[model samples]
Target: MASLKTTLVAATILVAVAGCAKKRPADLPPPPVDNSGPVDQGGATGPTTGAVVPGSDADFRRSVTSNTVRFGLDQYDIDPEARAILDSQSAWLQRYPNVRITIEGHCDERGTREYNLALGDRRANAAKNYLAARGVSPDRMTVISYGKERPEAMGSDDASWAQNRRAVTIVLS
Candidate 1:
């Protein structure tokens, strides 16, 4: 009887231990890949597992000439300098047709939130239009206005304001 009771307790403990084993959630997605190194100009990413994955946002940004284009204060027009950058971006977008992107418009801190928001919108649209005209599909692009909420450079000077007045292209997928 004593041996049988010991055997039963051992079985119970084995069952409890089995129940406590770690289980991977079936609904969870795989962990994201790290992409901090310099971009490969070739533009392809992910291993050859037969599973296709979109390129990382950072890689896409580095693959292009510039991820951001500067704009004149209170202006949404694409200047010559901005045009060059946009041209490069357009070419990159053409290469990665499946990659969707968002253009974030930003303005300096000199105007009211409402006014700045409108300016930012115009700025984002101007960039989007430029890329669209350069053969990138409009369907792959979206726009948002940040107004003065996000600034690349913080200061009450011309240099800082110039940095803030810009359009930044962000990869979505």
Candidate 2:
């Protein structure tokens, strides 16, 4: 009778263990295999997930032109319009893996020298942050603060100041 009880207990434990086995998630799909043609990487694998492949010369040029981001003046905040531009830029960057950009920060001549410098930094960083928010790789973007040094419009008025207080996106070759 004791042997029978022991065998039944063991069987129960085995059944419980089998029942507890993990099941695959219902939402997961099978890996996409490209078996129709030759493998991309010499029978290895294509680019990994979230991996950016280099772009061609034409692609780079298109990225440079299409991903240009502009900014507002006296404020380093990313606005809705700027966000829309950045979103397009992010798509362009993703499409052209070989593209990288530098966000140059500038300030108008209204503020003090040091204040302008800091504000320029803030503007540049803000632009980069916007791009990053839109899925552009942080590694592919750089920031530089010109601080009222390089003015697009050389006038000392509000119009020129507004133009000068800008973040220009430059493409890196």
Clashes of each: 0, 1
* TM of each candidate vs. truth: 0.69, 0.60
**Colliding residue pairs in candidate 2:** 55-98
Superposed Cα deviation of residue 143, candidate 1 (Å): 0.2
Clashes of 1: 0
Write out the backbone clash pairs for model 1: none
Candidate 2, residue 113: how far the Cα is off, in Å: 1.9
**Among all windows of ten consecutive residues in candidate 2, which has the lowest summed lDDT?**
30-39
lDDT of each: 0.82, 0.67
At residue 68, candidate 1 shows an lDDT of 86
lDDT of 1 by residue, 1-173 (tens): 99999999999999999999999977642232333345532334555642323454756666677888898878999989899999988877887888898888889999899999999999999999999999999999999888888877889999999988989887774
